[model samples]
Target: MTELRNPVIRGFAPDPSLVRVGDLYYLANSSFEWFPTIPIHRSRDLAHWEYAGHVEGAAPGGSLAGVPDSGGIWAPSLSWDGERFWVVYSIVRSVGTPYFDADTYVSTAPDVSGPWSPPRRVPSHGFDPALHHEEGRLWLLNLQNDHRPGGRRFAGIVATELDRETLTPVGTTHLLLQHDRLVEGPKLLKRNGWYVLVLAEGGTGFEHGVRVARSRNLTGPYELDERPLMTARDDPEWPLQKAGHAELVETPEGEWFLSHLAARPLKTPEGPRCPLGRETAIQAVTWDAEGWPRLRQGNARPTITVEVPDAEPPAFWGAGNCARSPHPPAPDNAPPYYTLRSPAAPSWTDPTSRPGRLRLRGHHGPDSLWSHHLLARRITEHHTEAQVTLQANPTTFTQSAGLLLWYNTAAYYALDLTWAEPEGEAQHGQQWQHTGRTVLALTTRDENETRRAAVQEVDADTPLTLGVTVHRAEAQFWYLTDGTRTPVGPALDFTRLSDDHGTRLRFTGAMAAIHAVDLVDASFTADFTDFRVICTSV
Candidate 1:
């Protein structure tokens, strides 16, 4: 028997779409504002996967510049005809104001890895564009935003025919399905002479679920399934609420599976929020005798462990270890900046430098999640650790530089250094003022403290090396000066740092970010000499 694995892809891989070409399988997911949106991964067996390539590079002129914190690549769909491979996705600039625009773009490559052509915008008015080729013609399926007077946010799905050669609309669009409530991530499939439309409804939240509709014609006057295909209520103990945004694929052996997004809370008892954001999960799919699809059950719940074939010898995996000259990893087709809550400038990050350094412009106070020029990457895994070296002279008590784990405007954690006041300032000097003498501090915002730090103090920073460790079990903050360890109060509690129910960290993702804030008019920069992640053994 063949077994399917869990989390076929990890770390901020949301809105998954998959396609199988011959003996190989390829997957693509949302990339949001980060350039090179739409990353593709390949796998021979459903288990082990490798990064294949990206659809487009960063938007021209950095159109997404200064706009950080999760708002770029949306849902993307991948499809393969007998000849070429195609990828379609949406781009949203921010979370508010015309929050989104449905611009469907397409790119084709003879193979997954290649000189991919520049993306061409499909002349269609919809989001989450999906391609379905039947006979000799191409059909486009998408989520139609409800724009009627006093209409709802997302109303329904739309379908239209496209020229097979150019992939351009050939005729007028047709409304395939509409439910004032059901919206987003629409995927179309054909089975046993019927066209099936799958969608996610209830706004990707704890109440989110997958629903299906069927029709005999491509332009559907469809019928809804009496029940949802999947839902968060499947298991009460499991905190994952929204378990939709799925794509279906048939394995080489003719078996089937569903790839979708699932969240797990950080703390179990009190249900800690997720720090890294929503992650991808996979499950085996089986069709009932009636031709309806059903998921296998064994008190079924999302898990980290999935079974697949073993790796062959001479695995040819990518390489680059710590202490060696760092290899330049490809840029993710998603946002790479860590964001603060303020509307600040974009941080300066040098990804090409050996042991690259990140320079953050200074800002005031702790409210840095909304808009601060901070350099960050999206956090995706359950258990991960990262380290960096910081160099800055805190001339004023207000001037400081350090590392942070940011999640939008309301939640985050940081470890930074502040300078001590000049000597004789205690009694002889007039009025006390903040100084940048380099004192170590740890700050966090969670359900318990809200915005206050559980642990904050003055510590030595003579050497300037700092490390932040995030274990599946806990989170720790440590610092080293001249290669000697300086102890802080204690390891802060990290049990509540997950997106189990998708609330606390509104976005269930995290990044290794650097920031300089509230400094006293001096330029402060933090050089990250060594940053490494040690993945747990499988």
Candidate 2:
């Protein structure tokens, strides 16, 4: 058997479900709110991977409309039952919603590079569904809600046999295992004549862990492991605490390995911080002399390299640079001219007035926010620098236009041009609100916070260029006004914004745009040119 490497895929690729079809290996990861959710990658060897395709086309919208940084896909399990490729995943509007309302669905295709079928919701009332096939019969194992008459606070595992051909449930649903503890992310496997059910428990937080239960019969009184297969308490060096939601696979060479999500905490004295969210890692799995599985490393930290039987292949996924075509290049690396978040009105129009420019019709005030007029691109890497040039005239006192780094409604950073009439200057002199203009704003369920920093603002009539760059791991921000670059704020401790709880700065990935607040019934138009995104690959 050959050894495997750590983090074959990195950065936001969590809740891994791996399947090896012959010599080729495929992996799927969770894409919380990012569109084209469920990123799929293919590898000839476990150590090298390439972006194969996305599970779903665009992010689900309408009744299925994806919520900004909220709705869309979650932990997905991918498998091949010798005939077709199947992917099962959960879709939810919000985290706190009832489980029954959150639906689980499946998509299949003859091949992985697929003209995949539209999602069909499995008749299951849960999230994170895993399908297992055994003895010529198919079965579905998933986490069902604890909504019974007087049940536990969280859900537990439930199973039902399904028709092998139709992929439909065939028998009555049976509760396989129900503990008072919160249990989810169940994967079933048959080993050594015993049906083993592996699951994640303790919620997906610092308390997370992986446990196992076994039963002689497919649906009987199963016995749980005296100890969890993996836990943060067992190994302190593990970069992430609360590591769970695991799937095991064997290489073509017959070596066993486990892939799971691990959180990397912000190295702060205050405690662990996870702004970027959980990332995926792999480790060797070994069975003791007694046939029970043990993680070879004891802890969850992934090794950097591994040895495999097959020769290494050349890199495939992200070698070339992506360019913006069809549209004119943005002037500086500033945000795009217009951006919309679940638009209420049709305010965006591609107009001939500016010749090859997208125009946004400004509405009344910030209260009339949420209209669709924003232009955005995916911000996947940690270090990104962008710039844009804009010409705008504000007629209303509330009218403003500028660059914004947005992650849904809750977290954002913006630099905008606001018009203010001086105290004694009548209605003649208008001041460009420059210093104390940067908006480090966040809106959470509990409170809304905005930290204003000084910036050199460009006046209303002149066309000005603005740019902002984010170096993620180092937590630094650089900005340029009119073409001269300068650092902004004290280097922000960005690691605090990781997805793990603690800091309020939730990293919902990054997007840049230029937008208009309430305009007090006046027309505001901005021409944007030369939009660019630059980054270094992992």
Candidate 3:
């Protein structure tokens, strides 16, 4: 027996689509506006998983330059039909509006890390589109959105058969099921001559849950399940919140398990905050005499630990023995770093320019949608420390570069090396004009306003080490100079960088990043080295 901890895949990995191809299991998760769009992971015993590769060029033209936050890729569904793997997802252009303005596409590859086929546009009924391959025929499942006034945005779940060659609609579109509550992320499987449709009920929030419906025929009036297969909505104090969007895969020995997304919230003064965003979790599944799938424990709530069949402990695991894999690490040539709104192209971001260092040419400010030169990695733990050595000389106020804790354009905190004028004594009735001094500025941005939290003068000639430490909901920024590390700012409210704090629509998780901005000209370049991030579960 293997002890499986909850959140088998940790941090920022949400809306998991799991599939088993023979003995190896492959999983894919959504990458909304970040490049290296769809991240794929592989597991051998279902207890230990490793980062195999990502769906290269998943983003159209290798860029999502102007995509709105949380509005690029939503609920990508991965499947295998004997030969190749297929990925279907929706790219939402407009968020927080009635008109999602979404486009769905499909791409196939012989292997997960592939020379994938160019994404061909598919029929888009709404976001969270999924593909079902049956009897050599492909079907598309999606939510039908009614955009008219007073109409339901989540009108119903619809399925349409697609022509394998042209990838177009062929047969009649069938309405699978409808409910008063929100339902999306439909996954189908056949069991005992019954076609079961697994659904993500409610929105992706505290009220999230997993519900099921089944029909005897491929397309029909489906019967909604009496109870949810799994949820934490009724249990507010449960460690895992917002559990839904699940997919199931059976092992070679016929044991079944479900993969879903859940969030771990930090207890705060006002409320709970989920800084890490939604993560992937697995639950054992079993069928009853009535043929409905239920949790192995016969309970609807999610557990922190589950036992599985046939597994061995890995040589290394994450803090708390949670979800790090023990497989041999990927080659050093390919690092797991992501860039915003664009690919890591040599035009703006180059790694070979400075040999051991990464060179980033300053582009637009962090608030810009077109081109923001940011290199980021997902924050995978509640307690983390990240540091980087930066070599940048910004002579003007318009040029700055530094470390960033980014959630979105509206919410973030940055400790930057920039130019600021210092106060000086002047002659009687005359003002003294002095060159601006290089200063370390800690700034915070939210929906209300952007304000400087602290500032300190620093020597401009020497390379500087900037670091941030986050423990639970609080964060502190620091800098190293002359072999001494000193705190640069007050303890910040890291809880503000969460999906529950603001009123805007946000889906992605927190990220520790290094960025540069040259609002005047895109010529200022910053070289960064010795970038490291260490995270542990609290």
Top-TM-score structure, candidate number: 3
| Worst 10-residue lDDT window, candidate 2 | 320-329
For each candidate in the order shown, give its overall lDDT on alpha carbons.
0.61, 0.60, 0.85
Model 1 gets an lDDT of 0.61
lDDT tens digits by residue: candidate 3, 12-78 = 8889999999888898998898877888888767776777667777777887888998878888999
Cα TM-score per model: 0.79, 0.77, 0.95
Among all candidates shown, the one with the greatest lDDT: 3
In model 2, which runs have C-alpha deviations exceeding 4 angstroms?
1-5, 57-69, 97-100, 148-150, 164-168, 234-237, 298-309, 320-407, 417-447, 459-476, 481-483, 488-496, 501-538
**Local accuracy of candidate 1 as per-residue lDDT tens digits, 1-538:** 3354455555566777888898787888776643345667776776656667666442433345434345655788889989998777765554543335545677778986656667777754557788887877788888776555676557678888888767777889998888856667888888889888878766665666777788999897988777777777556557554578877787767677677787665555565455555667776677777666666553234445545443332232453221110112444312233333322232354444422555556765545323355655555455666666776656555677777665543456778776554444453322244442346767776643554343344444443676777776466777775576664545655544444423432443555566677644536554455445443422
Error of model 1, residue 308, in angstroms:
5.4
Query: In angstroms, how far off is 389's CA in candidate 3?
Result: 0.8
The full ranking of all candidates by lDDT, starting with the best, is 3, 1, 2
